[model samples]
Target chain A: MSTTLERPALRTSRKVPPSKDSRTLLKSQIRTGWALLAPALLHSGIFIVIPVVAVLVLSLTNYSFGDTWAWVGFGNYADLFGDVDFLASLWHTVLYAIVVIPISMAISLAVALGLNQKIRGLSFFRTAFYIPTVTATVAVATIWLWIYNPGSGLANGFLSLFGFAPNRWLADPATALPSLMVVGIWQGLGTKVIIYLAALQGVSRDLLESSEIDGANRWQKFANVTWPAIGPVQFFVLITSIVGTFQVFDLVYVMTQGGPGSETRVLVMDIYQNAFQDLKLGYASAETVIMMIVIALFIGVGRLLQKADAND
Target chain B: MRRGVGLTLLAAALSVLVSSCGNGVIEKSTDGVPPAEATGTLRVLLPSFPPSTKGKEAFQKVVDDFHKTYPKMKVEPDFATYKNLNEKMSTSIAAGIPYDVMVTGVGWVQPFASKNIFEDLGKYGVTPDVIKEKSTPALIPAVTYDKKLYAYPLIADARAVALRKSAFREAGLDPSKPPKSLAELKVAAEKLTKRDKNGNITRSGFDLASATGFRQSFTTFLASTGTPLYVGGEPNFDNKAGLDTLLWIKSMINNVQPYGQTNAAQQPLVLTGEAAMGIVNGGVDCSADGIGQKNCDDLEFFRFDSGKEIEYVGGDLASIGSRSRHKDAAWGFIQTLTKPTTLDAIAKLNKKIPAYKDASNSPQAKSNPLSQFVADGLVYAVNENEVPSNWLEMRGNFDIQLTQAVLGQKDPAKVLHNLAGQSR
Candidate 1:
């Protein structure tokens, strides 16, 4: 009986210290929180939820742009499996992402580590690196077009200085996809570098000092101390980078146009051709559905990895 | 603290997302009155022409003249480049706020008409007979679908060969008598081709594998070669003429380095004396009005003897939107622009051949010798039927296969065979 009485007293002391006015204050705080979140929630519902639902509905029907529509019931999705062009595009997109993500992240992280050092003109270097991220994609693509010109472009001109013959950078089927990969890496490096730089700055100096005292080499120190400290950022960067690379359309469009016999064609470009050029909205919606599933799978795997890292 | 920043960033992102998604706003007209009795503003869309200020001024002047006829109504003009016109029309129609009247490409009539996005001009007194009388017979089928006319022919375009006389003289070839047969053309090309010490072609004899990709030029070649592209609603490129044309293209491709040149390299090649001859659209002015007077002074049109004398005819067309509230006003506006004098002025300013026969034979058009050639060529020119809904996709597929063959990636016979199989 005495033990039970003590438990009750403990429970009361922990929970019941509020008056009516305090309870009112708590309720108002909850209301304020919801009010602050309302605009974003509404926007997401309108844009994200509605469009996703519409695409899902459209995937089940032959929904052209105007009033004509019919319930096809899995017909579009079934047809996609038999589409040789769509399959080829899917394969190309995967290959592109596979090549671009690792190379892009590695280079960006390397540059970010270099920029994070106690070096002179650090701000200028960071600004210079970030300039490409701010430049319009069209402008960048146009400049690169001139640079890739075999006869008079800067790329061939540079190769000529080393006694090498000119190369058709964007024209040859064998080289076009890889050439675009290089452009993708170059254009994407800036944002990743900036993000990694911020994450690196947040790394604890005391941890680095202790690791150094342990007589760890630079690579070992980075592997043990810096990388673990920025582990979450690395996962975030990898996820975003993969997603960005999977949706690459502009560079492929401006440079190769999926040319030399569709060697450089990717998923998004294929979707565009079907949707706009061919006016196959129903078919395009189905393609978009496939893209959404791919992106979801990628993000799902990233989340699983993120949870696994947390467990570790 | 980090949570607060994350939410703030999320809010910003959501705002951008909402801004980018379309709102699905539609036209607000609920009036039951027929467009003929209604009075309102009319909108007209035209293609970006000549890429010059004078070209824009000429178009605006025509709009201003149309506005002069209707004092109570206003004419609003919008512009889009030829490359983007189809997308603009499709999006506008989808949004239900398409312009009252707009310029359309010859190939786009099918898609627009099939969707009922364009007004059937037959309902408004413009019939097939009217089109046959006013426009070339080749253009009659271009704007008609399901025996209903959807658009009025506006400008005319055809393919022709332009030769550099100076290069011919340098190659010890006569400029006046150009090659009439494929054999003669190949011989002349061989004689005129120039090579550097490295064995690289410095000056090409003929720019058949142009940097613009080979589709447009290939179509012109096919027509001139008397190859049937289509027969009984089927792609029929597996015949003798087709095979011969492919082999000819392959032979041309082997003589020079292909695919490294810029998109507009052909015109500049002729201008700068890097290519002796180039095939170009009839509307292109390489003379005093274009590249330079001196470079094009000796530029003469060559007639390829395909034995059938066939040429590719394509052009911009004009049509009223089906959903337009002021359809009558739009028709009136279209009529005003298509008038003989207005059409003549547009053609003169833009250096294009007028669609109407009277406009083509006008005093101003007669003064330009090239315009006469364009008009004459329209008689024998033919256009593929624009009715097939999948024509664009079919054409795109054919272009890819042709490019593969031209680049030596695939055998021409195999490519054509595969293309035929796919078409079937």
Candidate 2:
């Protein structure tokens, strides 16, 4: 009976009229919440929202960074389907994302797992893996260009050690995209590894021990405990990687310029060529719109998978 | 109320964007010119000189000379690269602050002029005849659009083929009698090509120097066939000469020289001894600091003569912006840019030949044999000029489609047809 008397109220009175001071305090809290959010809201509105709206509106017109513009409502979009360059770029970008995302994720996870173990020179190895992520894309591409040099590149030199024929890595259309994919995977590994490393470190050790006591093997321990524990992080990595691989430009621009007969041409490269090179700003904006929609769809699919995993 | 405010803000933003896009058309300049005593800043965009310390110093010297004429006028330079010049120009124009003076390349005049981005230099007494008398007559058609001079010639960037005397002698071919026709060139290249035990190209017979694309080489070869890539903005390469030129380039790839091959440094293979012969740029450095005088002595330059003995020539040209209020000062600045000493300094810094009629006598040309050869060949220069307003766009298409043909990924005829359709 004393405990019942001492218990705090679990709910506010439904029909009570608040005191002036209480109402003012609530209003002040609301104001503080808004004040905390204002900067980020303002930044998003100016940078992201405004540009997206501008691009959407511009996509309906034939504006070429010139004085005169005429609205041809969806004509640019209609022409985009028929444009061979646009279609090719879209296919290349999608193919790049499909090939790069899973391989990069798996490789990064394996590396993260290796680095997570007790080892000598662990910090050194970790830094070595993470360095590429921090390096500038242009600088990385330049170094890779040297590495892919046909006659004297490190790649050819390595091939010669095994008595294999030298390959024109970036200059050959058959190998250009694959060579770029290797760079893309290697460059993107560092960040994903770091993320996965953090997630692997956070996997509950007690749960792993319990699984082991239950006669679980290493594979079972990982499948049941570690993998599920890193589910949210895996979702995050997948979505971000999908978005990143879709927007790859600087590497391709510096390395091949989407060359060897447009073999490495990606969506962003095509959009850039249209906007800045061809001076077709409106058509490029339409390309941008389609790219955004595709990225959104990818993210949506990722969300559905996350939900399914949670249900399981 | 929050939703209402959000909608209102978006509406305001859209209105602002729409209104901003409406006003970017540059207005024609009024006849009245600003006085020489003008005090405002003159914004100049130049891709002519690089943005290096040496480039800036050379450009600053010209600016100082301009200040001598108009001491009160301030000059702000945007030293952009040719790759980024179009981007900078488009953004500046959209922002309603177009540069007062713009220095661009050969094929850029028509595209910019069609949009009225450039002022008609004829109003300031820069006619075709004036250009012919003062500069290389070959560049007149390059700077002219609709029978009016839109730009003044700055520097001529020429391409000529060079061969090694030692390599020719080893092949038992006369070095002095360079191949004049494509057929002779093919036969000579086949003999000069060297192979390793693995059937790899140890030394290329003829380096196209086309790691990027065959467009420039195609242009040079096409001009030798007595046809330009485009004329009056129409596709002129859809004929027999075009097909033959594409076939010739394809047949040579991976036979004499590898497709899309370049030295590690991306320098011309002829200079690096990776090839017996190759197309070289306007100038070669023969100083001890460069490829060395010994290597230079082994080289001899020649022009292609299929139907015409034509060398590919491109150049940088300066123009006044139509929207510039400081047209007279801009014109004055352009005059200082074209002075003999200034032209020589810029040509030396850029490793290009001055577009002046007497450029062969310039110290930069006299010191470099390749520059001298290019300067003398300016008379027989054929440039990708007098093209349609969409030449810039067409050039990119040509680069990619031509690459496809050279790589054997596409049929030459189909590619030509596709390119012609794009031009239309």
Candidate 3:
């Protein structure tokens, strides 16, 4: 008879809803959370969402930044297909991203691996590598411009000491884009190295030791133990690098202005010319939309890789 | 939680989209008034030719003088480099916050005017008769759109090949008589070029790779030949004359310094005595960054021609903003800035030619031998075809093709043909 009475009490308490005061407290907590997020939400809405939507709407019409907008549907997008400059610019941007991202990643990773060793003055070396990443883009470009100078420049002067001929680094059509790529890679390596160094700390030393005890070589040990550890960070670095490469403007503007036969003309530069120089805001908006799609695709691939790495 | 976050984001995006579309509708300005009757603060935007250069001080003095002249009217000056002026002006104009009077380039006049960013000076007492009387006849076309005056021609510039007499004499050529023909220029360049033991050029004969060398040389070359590259507002770069000109330029590049060899290659080479002849600004004082003022006594100026005796006049213009409420005050400021006295004063200090005929031929300008050629070129100056709103676009296209050709990465004919097709 006592057991039956205890079971009913337990069931009644278990099935009971929250008190009015508790419910009100939960509602207040949610309101506070929302209130905290309100500022960021407003900031993103005003700056990012509004501009994005406006660009999308403008891309569909022949909007010239005024009340005069004719709904041209996808005419601007259609025209982009046949626009040689647009095609060339897109190709160059992709080419740049491809050349820069891997090179930067490999160099940064190598440096990170070397610096991960508890060597003398490691912190100083790490700081040295990261200095370029913190330096202003204009300041970096200006310095590189002098370095790339054909005559009396440090690059050619160094080459001359080794019996190499002076090169018109940023001026020749054959070498301008490549020279710019070098600067891009150099400037980008710093941040990636720092991130990889931080990520390297998360790399399990016990796993590596066990692999070494299993008679694995350095490459094999790294492949099995370390690569997986830093897989997520590598993916993050790659996505950021690709995004940065796609949006490179100031460097090109300061260095070449897309010169030496449109060799270094990237999508952003093309968009800039159209939007401001050509005053074709609608056309530029369409280009921006395409850039957004391309970047999204890249980010999506990166996310997939991250997920696969997580699953593994 | 995810649903709530998504809903909040959606609501935020919707509100933003609504606000963006609601704003940015430009209200048409109906506040333009005759300059004589205007009274208010005049926001003047002018190009500040670097502080290190005399151009900055000269322009500042012009502004100061204007302020003194119009004591009752306030003058707000915003200075920018020419490189950033186009985009800056466009953004300001689109935002309806343009200066009362702004500096404009020759190529920018039509594009800006057509976009309704410039006030029709013709409506503000700057009629055709007044423009012709005040500015050069050749320049009137540059600042005119649809036969209406849109801007005041402020400064005039022309390009000429300045031959180093010393280099010519050293090359066993007559220093006194410069090359009058393309063939002659090539012969002189071949003799004047000095190569090191490794076949690298130590000194160039004729440096065609100056700052903005290709475009400047190409324009001056075409103008000298009297060939209008722009026919009916379209770039006809595939024509026989265009192809011939390209080939000629290619030959010149091959004989002279290879493209992009030195920094600011032409002027630097010429000034440093490394180059025999090269294109330069028609200014006597245009000695490369240093070396004081270049003397006309040591240099001779000649048009790059196959004997057509033509020259292209290029320069900046001043215009009143269409959206400015102080149109009269802005116009007054523009008129003051463009006055013969002010033009002459600034021109003398900056070593640039004044657009005003009287100011250009004043005793001060006459004393400068280099200004003589610039003034003479104004007689045959050909305004760039302004009918196409894509003037800057076309120039950019041409620059790319020209670069490719100069670098010898692409055949001139092929580049020109491709450029023509792309431009079309």
Candidate number of the best lDDT: 2
- In model 1, what is the error at residue B258, expressed in angstroms? 1.7
- Tens-digit lDDT string for candidate 3 (B308-344): 7656677768898876776766766787788777777
Across A130-247, the per-residue lDDT of candidate 2 in tens digits comes to: 9998998888998998899888899999999999999999889999999999999999999999999999999998999999999999899989999999999999999999888888
Q: Can you write out model 1's per-residue Cα lDDT over A69-103, one digit (the tens) per residue?
A: 68898899898898767887898998998889889
Interface RMSD of 3: 9.3
lDDT of 1 by residue, B182-285 (tens): 76877888887888776667777876635635656555666676664654336666677777877787788648435545444435355456667756565445
- Name the TM-score of chain A in model 2: 0.94
| CA lDDT scores, all candidates in order | 0.72, 0.86, 0.73
Question: Backbone clashes per model, in order?
Answer: 0, 1, 1
lDDT of 2: 0.86
If you superpose only chain B onto the true chain B, what TM-score does each candidate give? 0.83, 0.92, 0.83
Alpha-carbon deviation at B362 in model 3, angstroms: 3.0
Model 2: residues with Cα > 4 Å off, grouped in runs: A1-19, B1-36
- lDDT of each residue in B65-112, candidate 2, tens digit only: 998878878899999988888867876765667799999988888888
TM-score of 1: 0.89
| Model 3: DockQ vs. true structure | 0.36
Give the docking tier of candidate 2.
acceptable
